[model samples]
Target: MTLRLSVISASVLLALTTHSIAFADDSAFEVIEVTGHHEGSYSSVSTDSSTPQVDISGLLEQLPGAAVNGNGPLTGIAQYRGLYGDRVNTQVNGVTLASAGPNAMDTPLSYASLVNSERLEMTRGIAPVSAGTDTIGGSVKVIESQASFDEISGKVAAQYQDNGQRSHLGAKTNIANQDHALLVYGDLLKGSENTTSGSGNEIAPTTYDKNIFGGQYRFNLGDSGNESIAIGYQHLETTEAGTPALPMDIDFIRSDRVKLEGIHALSSWELNWHLAYSDAKHGMDNFSQRMKMPSMNARYNNADSASFDGAISVGKDTWLFGIDSQLSQHNSVISDPTMAMFNVDNFNDVQDDTYSAFAQWQQDINQWNWQLGARVKHYMTDAGEVSHSMAEMMPAIKMLMTQFNNADRTQSQTGVDLVLNGRYQVNSELSWIFGLARKQASASYQQRYLWVPMQSTGGLADGRTYVGQMDLELETAYQLELGADFSSDKLTISPRVFLHRIDDYIQGVPATDPAVKMAAMMMGDDNPMQFANVDAELFGMDLAAAYQLNDSWSLDMNASYVSGERRDIEDNLYRISPPKVILGVNYKSNNWLARVEGLGVSAQDKVSKTQFEQRTAGYGLMNISVAYDADSWMLKAGVNNLFDTEYEDHLAGYNRVMGGDLSPGERMPGTGMNAWLSGEYRF
Candidate 1:
């Protein structure tokens, strides 16, 4: 039977290579480096791989103004130093997860799944306000994995690559009777993919699936050690594995979540509380194809979403305070492809709502240290469309169209956000940091669904309706950050610099003139949408260092650089930051571990052609990994793109009728040498 299951998977990876962690006498299980900051003197990097699809988003497209649009097995809506869409913001454990194509090339926890994370936080720019509200290009968090005492844990994993193969299994349990505590966990996964492009051509072969479940409970009211209460529940489902000539097709996605928390202590302050709720459902199937039309275009859609959050906290002198709230709702439907022809029908509907409230503070006033915040938000939208074409046909198609209607439009917004931060202590090694922030932007649902496609050849254009301009304001931003961090006794340096500004920066222009481009399409209100208040800028600089040369060795490095543009036609506005430099090297003992990494990018040449249909050209990459550990089971193995080079990223998208390049573009496509093995067991 396949050689007794390959000798029981090599004796269970030689008994987890001999035990997961021991660290030569350091307990509390070392290895915890989590730090991320935005604003208040932003400059962050506290390693354990700066997450982006489980690790550095494929070496950050080899720096130098990075770019990656699409290619294969993609997940990781990347953008760093140059930002993208909705000003980048992602959260988990602090809520916020909603996105299923409204186009930013998809990202909202990227189809969820990161091997049961227990820490992953990233903040780029103009952040801080206690990490909530429209972040101006930054914020990513995921923290999951809980259970302690009477521990009962489990994991099973599998992998294969050349474009597909993955399997996973999980289990967790923790219970303590005597003070009341309970915890439970579950996981299941599946994956498949096939891709090859960027001058190798093979495109399309995808399959991904996942399911997860969770539970947690806690209680304690004695021991004068204060008090505690916690409750949680989670459920998730995912699906989508069909691609090639895409026009949309995804028919499964579900989520359900609940949470509650509390803590207490008196005699001089200490209190905390939180609440959460979530519900999601998404489905899709839509296609389009033309160019010698023989008819073939389908449609079907669905979306249902919900969200809520609440929080409170307190403390003083040296400070710590909080108050926050959030709410979200979505409902959508689309079904109109000539209603499967013959006795036609059509449909479209939409609704969206959002709300927010905030207050926060964090402080220290000796060598200087601070944080402050504020926020307010409210938004709403409603949409509708209908058509019942050709009832019982003929009779000149029911007298040239007997049914058509549209009515039901609404949009609303209310916004506010502010923050300030500071730090100092320019001695004993070094320290200095600064921050300032502001975010304002509201009303979005694809700019209120605006479509205009009719460049001749069997038309369907002349649909111009967008009621939102209701003095549509908000969409303002301001940012400033300065940095300094130094250490000695085995190195640890840091450097940071940033500047950002945006005002009425909601862009989209082109209302073609000359009789609306000879009446080719988009009429009403002279279509050619508008939302302006332009003048944007971004500045960047980042440098990091790490060193430790004893007891097992260590070394690390970092680099970053950015320019400007959000508008003012900065000559096709380049800078979507990604390159400047980044490098690394590592080696360890006590069960062996090794690593080598490099990435570099430059040569953009002031791009054009819509920035080369989403920039590219500038690459360098190399990666290597080695793993081992032993005792009570735990083992790992690795080999990834040791040199298969070919790159692009920035959630690539653009294919002006297939000549703009970037759709099905090249990204994370350097996997010619790949390998992985994992094993674990504990009792």
Candidate 2:
């Protein structure tokens, strides 16, 4: 039942299914239609690799430095490149997802399944301005199938994991005829999991149950290909047995989203417009027992947002513009035996609005391709809060409390991005590319409405609150990149290097209190402190290559290295980024494919003064996967962490009390040896 054992079994199952496959003559590296572009064009080229077929969530887990929070599938939030929450942007069918709070558990786009997607695109760093300006990490855009000739097209898949005694089943169908199209997808999953780590002793057996469902409809407007409307809905529910660090007695979530978009192409220019609305509610039951006081709490969160986007293109140059807005509200009331006399009730609401405009020019000269682009964006946030004493509502103990006050806050900022890129052919064997970008980050909601926890004396004490000073400046970054694409008859390789400089960083400071000591220990510099014009820099490189040694055999490799540091005199800094490397190889034949991958992370000497920081020793992990294609059917199986190696991902953040040691649920624990078997049929 161990995670390691499950991974091993999965590897064996994959090896048994694969046979041999012949290599095709088609180019492995070719430009394909991608949705990362706001204009919906194929002119943009990206280095992201795609699997033969995969779920949307599964595909995201494969990104470098990414991790999943939940035990099973489809229910967890994705932490990409060490960034989580609002730091990453997600757009589905031209609809953006933003939350009211910074908590990762309340992410907006958690879906039931993605089987009906026509295509999906992942772009890092440089995303389209229409996608919004908050994406400092990257962006993910999904394109669903809106038009189809078939009356119905669908598929079913299932997988079982031995380590956790887990099972998953998912299905999706698309029905289309004439002017209408309907697509539906759903998944059911259950898993009982155990961990193996330093905190394994404290780690308890966890069980997972989940269900997700979604549907979409499309209506056509004439045959001009310029007019159409679509609407979609997504819902998911999940329950976890909880962990030692944070126990969850109950959890439930429901969401609904709809979108409408239209396109018009005239002789002189092309026009496109989209509108979207979403509503979501997250309910949770949590029990926190620290020291003598045990607090049982239930919270209900409601969120809704809307957006509008449009673009106009003329000749080789085009200008695009859009507006994005969101509203979020949260309410929580706790029942505590020790703090019953204090009586606490918490409530807050926030709204964010953004507007942006961008221009792109694409020109082809001789054998070289050139691109130039610039985007300008303005961001604003409004927030307010209301608090009341439980005694005031209850008949038992009536206590006078401060009346609700308008804790109103307002902030505004403007930033711009400039990009320049070009590609040149040196010969049949080599091609060169160069790209440079300058990005600026506007003031976020957190930077303006600063709140620090007050020492406990009663329900509500004079909490230290400070209005954001206008002295704050926008953060900025300048980056330079160079890369090469090389290929021979049998082998293709690509390597790239990037350098970045960032300034005007903000960090939090801690308050002096005995009760908050434990909380402060885990907080590090994450507390809402002061903002300073600090400087930081990072440089990294990555390479990917594949070679066909013979007709039925081939090899593949991928690796990345990153190093970063913050130069601030006020305080010793934390490692915002760590050096990481991933190397993988594969062998494939007609009915069989096998792969081995290695993940390695270097030591991070960066540490904070109040925290006991130990440099994570470099560790490597191995994984393998394989599949077989049969007559009108295909069977796929795989094992992650083939070696059952105990290693920690460098991108992990801290929450556990154990110092420096890897916790069972701290990072994405590398499963020992797990196997999965899935069957697919094609018509």
What is the TM-score of each predicted model, taking all chains together?
0.30, 0.76
Identify the runs in model 1 with alpha carbons over 4 angstroms from their true place: 1-72, 78-339, 342-408, 412-414, 432-443, 446-486, 493-545, 550-553, 556-623, 626-673, 676-683
lDDT of each: 0.50, 0.47
Residue range 1-683, candidate 1, lDDT tens digits: 23323332332232233211112121111122213332343322221222123222332343222233232243444455666545566666666655544332134554344445554445534567666666766665555654443344544433334434555556556766546677777666665544443344333344566676887777776564257777878887767733322344345667787888877875577777778887777664533311112353355556566767777766544445566555555554555556654322212344555566666676667887677778777777664542333334333223212221232356777777787877677777777778787777664555543322111100001112222232346677788888766665656655567887777665444444333232323221344333334567777665555556555655554556566565666543333543444455556767666656655555343432222324545565665655554555555555455555555432333221122223332332233434444454544
In model 1, the worst 10-residue window by lDDT is 453-462
Write the residue-wise lDDT of candidate 2 on 59-153 in tens digits.
Answer: 44444333333422323444444333445566666566543222334343444254445444555434444444555545666665554433677
